[model samples]
Target chain A: MELLKPELGLIIWTTIILLSLIFILTKFAWKPILKGLNDREKTIAEALNTAEKTKLEMAAMKSQHEALLNEARQERSLILKEAKDMKDAIIGEARDKAKSEGAKMIEEAKREIDNQKMAAIIEVKNAAGNLVLEVSEKILRRELNSKDEQVKYINTLIEQSKLN
Target chain B: MCEYLCATKKRVIALKVLKFKLFITIFLLSVFSVSLVSAAHGEEETNSTAPTEHNESKKEDGKFNAKKVILEHISDSHEWHFFSYPTGDGYKDVALPLPCILYNDVNGFSFFLFNKLHHGAIDGYSLNAEHHIGRSDGEGFYDLSITKNVFAMMISSILLIWLFRSAAKGYGARPNQAPTGLQNLMEVLVSFVRDEAAKPFLGKKTDKYLPYLLTVFFFIWINNMLGLLPGGANVTGNIAVTTTLALFTFILILTGSRKHYWMHILNPPGIPFGVKLILVPVEILGIITKPFALLIRLFANMTAGHLIVLSFLSMIFIFGQMSPIAGGGISIFSIAFSTFIYLLEMLVCALQAYIFTMLSSVFISEAIAGGHDHDEHAAEDLP
Candidate 1:
């Protein structure tokens, strides 16, 4: 028989070799290799997903922190405003009370001074009246019942009242 | 009256003889005509003549010779250097020559190693030298000779895997850490492969095949790129190389196939009984055809580019044989054209490699997705 063409021989051998290799690879190499590959892939993917998760978590934490910071700032401002308002209110109340108390004490002191002055004036008027009455009685007893003397005493009394 | 009748008959006979002489004159005149014979011969020769000089010359030179040309073509493949480097001691090119010298020897298991050791004695015309793996050119017992391209492919693959693994190891638990050097580059490749190639088709299963897919992608791409280099061994261009790689894919797809995968191929779901008969066979055939297409696409694309380049180079030699001036012009143009094609081939090599890996990953995804739904689907189709 004529020898096969080299191309043909090559083909036959290639088929046999490749087929057998395929079989062996399928049986032994393929599964383990692919499994290892798959396992590696899974691990890598898990790593990536973890990275993604971490990134998201970081973002969330950042926002939460910002919110907390903002709330604290607002609370601080509110406390400052309230403190200032309380101080103003206390100062306003104290000023209003001091003005009213000062005005009331001054009015009461003036009333007491007015009552003593009125009592002193009344006593002086009484003493002056009694002294005038006694002086008139003594003068009338000593001077006799003369009409001219009575008229003169009445004139003196009128003149003294005018001077007082 | 009888004598007068005899005189008239003699005259009539003399006239008849003169008429015969006129007929002979016309016949001789026709035989001597030059234009008529010449025109007649011209039309006849147009229909029946053989031995056209142009065709005969071509036949003598033997055009369209598939057998002889194929051998010459195959032999030309042997001339390709598997690797390249700059010419000198202690240079990077030094390592390149090792693979080339090793690839040229008689192929065997230890073929590459032995050639590297015995490069001093080897030369042209010694195409069939004694190989170290106990096989000579004539023996043909073992053709397991690892070509330089194969070795290069293996080396490049190992490097790529190592780079990626090292990159992954670099990621610290701290969030603020930056990846260094090769790690950064590897991160880009890993992300691109995952996001662009595998993730779209494989979806959730994208992670399952990422490493294998990445390895295949780089392996094929690097080898294909090497093939495009001048004097480089076209490992991917070899049908055996493509076929072996394709076989691996085939096995992966087959083994990873979920039950639903088989059902879709053997008995599709949600089809009427009558329709199922037609669709089932087509689906089954499609399963086989997908991988077949992968094989042919890679083989044909790789081989065709090489064939075109070789054909262009052959033109220069053919023209040179005819005339030096003609050869010079043709060679210049051919070189330009070959350069353009080589650049295009570089892109194609990477594309084909990526396509192969992508398809393999898709197949795996489909297989894993098949699951229990396929059984129910197949059962529903049953009469």
Candidate 2:
């Protein structure tokens, strides 16, 4: 009977002991230990989330960088083509201007050379005419002194005039 | 690296110490068993020439009554009796007789050591033949002494406080760091109870009930372990302790239950009226039985475990009544078998704690309708 009986004292003691144990453990034991575990869990989860976000961001940045590099490559080729076209246009314009200027200068030199040749010819003719008149007078005077010599000289002069 | 080396070295030392302690305990238990049989043998030798009726009367009294001893072992007592040694003339009990407190209408209160009332009476209070304290006049008085179970509970409570507070201190000293040593060990148990027992059932309300759940788990487990010590008091095996624990859970259920719980119990939706009639009563019975089951299951398991181990240990004496040679030979087998049961009981200690916490969580979760949505979804899926 004693073995089976639940003593009121033990019941009271158990109740008191258990309730107080729950109270004390709740305050000191379970609270802090659980808090530590929870805090650690939360930090771990947060760290994982941050890591995942960072990985995504890195991937996104990598793709953005690739796109930027591609755009730069395209822009460089376009600029290079524009520069080559401008160089070609400037070279062609310069070559054409040099050719035209050279031709005009050569034409002006040829005209001046022709004008100098005509002026030289005119002066020479005037000089030759003056000399010829002097020589004919001298000859007429000399022939009056000698009639035969004059006639002969006149004939020779007429023949020479005709041959001339 | 230093840490690791230190830990391994500490573990080896601890293992050695544990083995030595186990050896000493087994050796002491064997001595006690031998002493018990020798005492019985002495009684039998003196009574051998006596008449049959005389011997029969003396048989149960002094011939190593295993039942009495086993019952005494599992049962609570006013004294923490360790063991007895035969003195020059008679046996002297080597035990700590606890103090007693008594109160009645006549005498408001009386306080004294248990031995003061050993002979006759102390201030109108006497401990009966069974050592239960009672008033000399046979009137009722409140027996409020700290019995063996109470003492054991106190020790376990203090132990739990010390253990967890040290872990708490660890967290306090180094927050958000990896746990080490005792803190690590405690974290394993705490995390286990939370993840395995509390969270799976409680869900969002896991934190709210953690203290209660954690307390129950540690209390039962620590007490169960304490009871496994040589001559340790059976704290969890007591009905009072389990009842109190169950009552706490019951109160929590009552206070925490939601409307859906009652709705599901009292009025079922889309069910046959006749089925509702049957299911309603069953659901209502389920409420009380949840806690009741928690109470009986723990008490029965712990008590049965102790009973088996002690009964196995007592086998030597039971056989000794037949022959001394048989007694000596069976002692070896009894010790081995009992040691096996003892190790099994160690596992049962933690297992029973887990079961109690799990069932409590299940019942609590049911009451609070914590997993109502999941259940509803499952129902939809099934249909």
Candidate 3:
């Protein structure tokens, strides 16, 4: 028990030092350190806020990029459609022009055929009259009639030929 | 214009004269009151038989029946002892055992040594076999007397409580609020603790333990400083003080032990069974060693400071008996060295306290965070 006295002294001194320190530090030192800590907290918060805002902005930019991509796809599809429609229209117009030109050429050929038939009939009548007159003259020569009578026959033949 | 100026100057002179007279009167009154009170107290101290009577009562209480350490030191010094109201002459004579009269010798008989069981005095001093009674005279000044050490500790605690309470009430975080008197001093101390001590050890938890750490820091510092006073109280020089503090640390570490902490200490992973067996004992030893180290560090620092001071002071006495001239020369150098050590002691006092508290907090934090668990071994064994 007597040996423990030293331990008691140590305890008492420790208590005094502990109490005094608590008093001194709480009064003199805590505020500034606390303030510094708070300041650090605020700075961290600000940094977090900035990071959040940047994240949002990046998200928005990504969406905008997606919209642009969609627009490009739509534009490409529209251009392809427009090109196809233009090609079909041009083909239709060309087919119509070819049909009209073929019809006009057929009508002109029919008109030219009618004119050639009329001219051929006139030429055939002239040639038949010439042949009959030549045949009548040959038959009269073979029968051997008098000179006066031959002259009269030739005139008659011409007249008959003209009547025929 | 000249007439007006002269009139203003005359009025100013009159006011100054009145202020000077008022100041002188106030000063004289304060000085007179102080002197009167002191004189009254001095007379009372001389006339008071109360101390002797209290000392007799304390003697009856069975304190210091054994070799009284405080008395030993004082007696060795051969100085005249006196007592005040709280501790009168008899009360002073009635030696208070270390640790608030928790334990003391029976029969109220003081002696140099007693041989009860062993039937022989070890080194001509009383021997208690049950208790590992190592003398401070051997371990140095810090281990000297328990009562004085505890007194110093208590005083330091009171000082801390007072210092912080005032600061907390007076000033907050507002700038331009210049700290007046003690408040200014307190603010500086707080800053030093936060920046220098608390910041490094505890980091994020630094803020949580700021108040406690600061309390410890100033308390230890002030006591260490007080120990260096002329009479050489050497409260910090006691091993018991450091041991109690270390015990507090040990308790904190155990209570705050986390799962991870236990795993690391008891069943460390990535090591073989054979190695672990070797390591387990060592690890357990380490746990005990932490507090032991803390005790030694604080005890050694405080004791060293006292020894240096005492050694220098002893030169004055030692050489003074031989030759005054040689003694005077030695004392000059001694005083200079003592002053320098005193300044260092002031820092060490605070530093040691901070280190102890910081390490304690870290230990507790590790435990409370579930750092260590015995079940970890079973979990690891499972396929």
Candidate 4:
């Protein structure tokens, strides 16, 4: 029976208490609590977003670095190939120039040798003529005094030069 | 996908913490409320006047009025009565009388401490054995007096203010840091009610109704716990308290109701004319019954919990009246069973508070679900 009687004072008091409590809590407690919770939530979300962005950026930078290295590697190989080709061309040109110069020098030496040989032969002939004249003069001196044979050899050479 | 799954795993952990925290709060709130009662009981013990000698009167009669004692324990009174003690000569009834305020046609407002009427009638006002104040002249008057239940509420209300105010200050003092102590307790409960109770039903409109829901939840929760303490007022058990709580939900439902709600109630869609005639009245009845169910559920659960506990305690005295030996033997059973029952009641306190708040949000959501216009707005919002 006592349980059934929902007292009037209690009802009114409960109404007043609850209404005021709602007002006060809504104003003071729930507002800030909710706001703080929301702010924290926003911060956490932002952190996760930044983390994801950083991870993507890092991956992009890694790929970009790899691409730059590959370009540099290709450029290096191309420069090496060009240098090898230029070295081979320069070496071939130098060898050809040296070979032609050596051939020309050998031809010039041969011509000089030929000229000297000719001069030597002419000298030997002159000597040989003098030697024949001397031998004939010796034979004539054996026969009749040296002065008369020498004059004979000189006269013979003079007549031969005039005929020529 | 990884990120979403991680978030879900975090949410599950967070929900566990919330439940644990809410558990601490109600349990701690009971202890806190009981401490207040202890202080009051101590004061009343020193201040209580001794009754005229009824020394060992019950022993002489060998009769223990278990029903009267248990009912009085569960009911409200004009004063806070702790217990009765027998001295060598007389017995002592420790009670703190409250100020009585009444309104009648003859007397607009009369005020006095309930102790004034302790001895006899005062100014034609008399207190019945049931602790109701009535006029000797047989005139009905409004009892605006601060009864025991009222004082208990006042204490809890003040405590509520202090707690939440401090929590609000914690929010100000520390904006984004994790909650600690009382602030943490309040936050967990607030979030729980928001997420588990309001958000599930009210959805985006959760913030709009969170305050009222939180208030009623904490009110019922704290009061239910307080009532479980020895000699605490059965505030939530009282039908009046639950009715008032229900009235708040009913008002919210009625006021926040959109046109579509009434249309659905008055003329449910896709129904024939004959079916509409039958269904409309049932739908209207449904509106009233929603809150009524909220009221009765909380009131009955709280009242029954107290009743079972009190009945268990009464068993000792009942068996003691049979024989002192039987009483001594059964006390272990009574106390052990009652302790187990008491723990069960503690859970029911949380359960009842939860049911009341959840059901309330459900009703409010039903009223405020404004129909397909929201979907149309969503469609219109697309590029």
The TM-score obtained by model 4 is 0.73
DockQ values, each candidate: 0.01, 0.49, 0.16, 0.53
User: Over 4 Å off in model 3, which ranges?
Assistant: A1-6, A9-164, B1-146, B172-181, B199-208, B365-383
Residue range B268-297, candidate 1, lDDT tens digits: 777899999898888888777778777778
Docking class of 2: medium
Model 2: share of real contacts kept: 0.79
lDDT of residue B33 for candidate 3? 35
- Inter-residue clash pairs, candidate 2: none
**Tens-digit per-residue lDDT, A57-141, candidate 3:** 9999999999999999999999999999999999999889988988988888888888888788878777776667686657555
Model 4 interface CAPRI class: medium
Give candidate 2's iRMS in Å, 1 decimal: 1.1
Candidate 2 lDDT by residue in tens digits, A24-43 = 98899888888888899999
Better of 2 and 3 by lDDT: 2
In model 2, which runs have C-alpha deviations exceeding 4 angstroms? A1-4, A59-164, B1-36, B43-60, B270-278, B370-383
lDDT of 3 by residue, B1-383 (tens): 99999999999999999998966764554344344334334444553543332232212332212223232332111121233233323223323233212122322322222112124433323223322233322422122233444444556556656666666554454333455776667667667767776666555555556666555556566767777665545655666666766776687677656568777789988999999999988987888988888778877787776666556555544554344455555555656677788788777777776776666665555554433344564365355
Whole-model lDDT values for every prediction: 0.58, 0.83, 0.57, 0.81
Question: Which of the predicted structures, 1 or 3, would earn the higher lDDT when compared with the native?
Answer: 1
C-alpha lDDT of candidate 1 relative to the true structure: 0.58
By lDDT, the best candidate is: 2
